[model samples]
Target: MKLKQLSVALFTAATLTAGSNSKADTITTPEVITKTTSAFFNCADYEVVGVCFWLYCTITGCTVKTSAKVAHYNPEITTQTYRNAEKPPWVETRVMLDAMQAGHDGSLIGIILETMGSGLDELGGGAGSENKAASHSNMTFTLTDSFGNPVLLASKVIGSSGYVCDPQLTPMYPYYVSNLDTVAWRFSIPEMFYPQSLNPFGSLLGSNSYNWGGYYPRIGHVTNHDLVKESGLIAFRSAHFLSRRGESHVYTTIAQNSREGFWPPGPLTEHSGKWQQLAPKGETSCKTFPLSAGTGPSDGLSGYRSDDGAHVWNLWRRYKCCKDRGDFLYDIEW
Candidate 1:
């Protein structure tokens, strides 16, 4: 009955693998990079935006060099939320945190804020402290080649397309770390004092009353009962803060105006970018927030909350660029 036994084993494996919300705890750096890069290719959102012209010169004469300008979304950030800051579920972030600790031990101000802001740091869900769950988050740049593709995927893209330009920011950098920015992230500081934060029409994600939970005052604390939605809000808040400049955060601006030969993405606007679930479970496709933001056995989003309230999402942003052809940019035929 050896063949029969093999068949039974295969059936069992298929049963386990067939689910929308199947999950894993932590995602390694290689998996994150590979999956995201593969998703980039699968997206099929690349387009020819315009034609760029450059002035090419030779000893004999000068000529106009032309190339196709293309635009597509890039997985520029890996945003995650979890209860603990000392050890996140992201492999790369954990490694970076260790190195940061080794180099600087801990910031004196950070230690002070952590102590003074103990219970107030993250408000938990449910009544009383028994069901309480605290959350912290990080927004970090994804690892990519100079041209914005993952190292392994870069070769394939370059081989196929011939050329691609670099992104505005370098890869593998942390844009926002909740624990490191306590005054603003934990306490909300002047953000709470802002007029829009208090207004009914401004500074909110989804709505406070729609059972989706409110996302204003953009801090690490919330009173929602749903763990998944809470984590989603935390991630969304991180994205919102990183999109624009002049917020109460230490973030590199992602906004750029189109220049001569190169064209970069502008500031991130709500509903423009999309999120792909990376941990707990993974999705082959990505969609805008709230629409694809549900999780669990009842929901269709296909991922469940982690045991420690940890979650990861790949944030994809649109970018347009063209290869530098010659000495100076001549014109863009849009």
Candidate 2:
């Protein structure tokens, strides 16, 4: 898994399952998103990870553009704080994300869902231990227009499989090494066996895909942490590619803090390490509530690192209060 030599807090399943219910702690970056703006950015300094690459738009917070509010959330906010699987870890939150865009003559709309699912995971393939990624943070989407309601529910995690490759792997190709390098990967099954934004059919900014034989929008394992509720033992790592044509965003909410922004899961198309200013919406401070008793504000809404040796991971209470109430307003933000 690209293990950076950074210390992180450990939030094991046994510890979390002991009490289970975690407080709903969230932090809206910019810490003051006043307006809405859309632009591309790359924040590798902050350790923001993407599906394949390792960055996100610093200014716009890695947005997924849409004409309407995707979910009940504002365009500049992301929930799923407290860094663990949801308590009662088997329940799935309905409408975790709900966004629709007019399609096919503006008759139908595209429905995207990012439900927080919980179930026992027997993680056998990559890791030999049981994990929760088999269920949590699963993405399900559907596009409905006057013509029809085509549904694209996620059968697995995100980026596990993409639609860019054909059955014979003729299309989904390798991507470049860097934003400026722009060199494609050697086209051969032996050279390119995995799905990566860099290994696109042509370029990292071009049509990239995954092995659809796995799942439509397959996701890899979340390294060092689960989606929410502080439920995980160790980190996981794997490369993923973007499938359909839509907005994309990511988060490394579990990583350590003192950071300026969230870790992006991938690059901003082909742009990385570039800067772009987005329009500020208004002026607002995203709130952070108190954690357990003596935990204090330090653990309330924090950014933790998988390698950072700190008590912050076990200090804060799982976010049961705000819960992932309104995170789905924009196109897609993980």
Candidate 3:
């Protein structure tokens, strides 16, 4: 089925099973893979942005070839944040991460991990972890990623495979883990002292301060009264950190420059990109954080907050690309 259709089908199925007594503590790999089919693919977002003209050089003469430049958002990274590193909501590697935590504790010399495994989730504030937050703070951010998404794999088998774009990052891998960077993530290092961090208008999450909160310091701890907004701010902070290139953050940049046949997305900024919730109940559609009042699901709704204080979201950014049809890209026409 088409990706858009798959979303409809999944929602229908979820509605039918809404009454089931069984519940999931954390989002599972199988569940993620299943939700990806529909969550990643959105026919409405996919569009022909422009046309690319390429020079096809031959032995005798050269000809210009044209290709359609298509633009759409790809669910590139699975960003997750939770209170505990050992019990990440992503179930596939929960036990393994727990074992690593144990090993770190038992070693005689104390083998502090320079780098953890790729499957590990972002270590949000926990009981004894570095990110532990004050009681008044509703939550802390621990941004992490399980690399590339499986939606690309699913798209290859689907009938609309031609529309799919190659992922810039590897699949099922960890590109960024907040726990590793203590100075920057915890104290916000120099970022907190920067003018932007000090200014309320700088790096604002929504249109105004009333929406969510400022994005400075890029720390995980949030004192917002609403749980849903807090989760959204944490997700936004992580995305902001990853979207740009900086030595402060231990992460790979998701921003890509436009090239000849491939036009990738640039740095993520508020209002420029959208988010799709993937855990504590997956969402079928995408929306901005601190969604406008009276919009879909808001902070007033119940159950959006995860029981374990773990939340996962897929960052969707726009990209444009065209199939290579000639020797060199000559020009682009709108």
RMSD of each: 11.0, 22.3, 7.9
Residue 60 alpha-carbon offset, candidate 1, angstroms? 1.9
Lowest summed lDDT window (length 10), candidate 2: 143-152
Each candidate's number of clashing pairs is: 1, 68, 1
Candidate 3 collision pairs: 141-220
Q: What is candidate 3's lDDT per residue for 235-305, written digit by digit as tens?
A: 78877867787647766666666666776677778876888877886777777776554333443545567
1-334 in candidate 1: lDDT tens per residue? 4432433343334334433332377765556665676676655377887787889898999998887887777776677777655446665455444443332235544464557655433322222243335743332111110012123234334623524544554344556656555566656787787776787456445544443444567777665656566666777776776777788865555556666666656665456787777777666677665654443566764445666677777777776666777875655655
Model 3, global lDDT: 0.62
- For 91-158, candidate 2 gives per-residue lDDT tens digits of 11101111111221222211111111213231111222445667443321111001000000111122
Highest-TM-score candidate: 3
Candidate 1 is scored at a TM of 0.74
TM-score of structure candidate 2: 0.20
Query: What order do you get sorting by lDDT, best first?
Result: 3, 1, 2
lDDT computed for candidate 1: 0.58
Model 1: lDDT of residue 75? 73
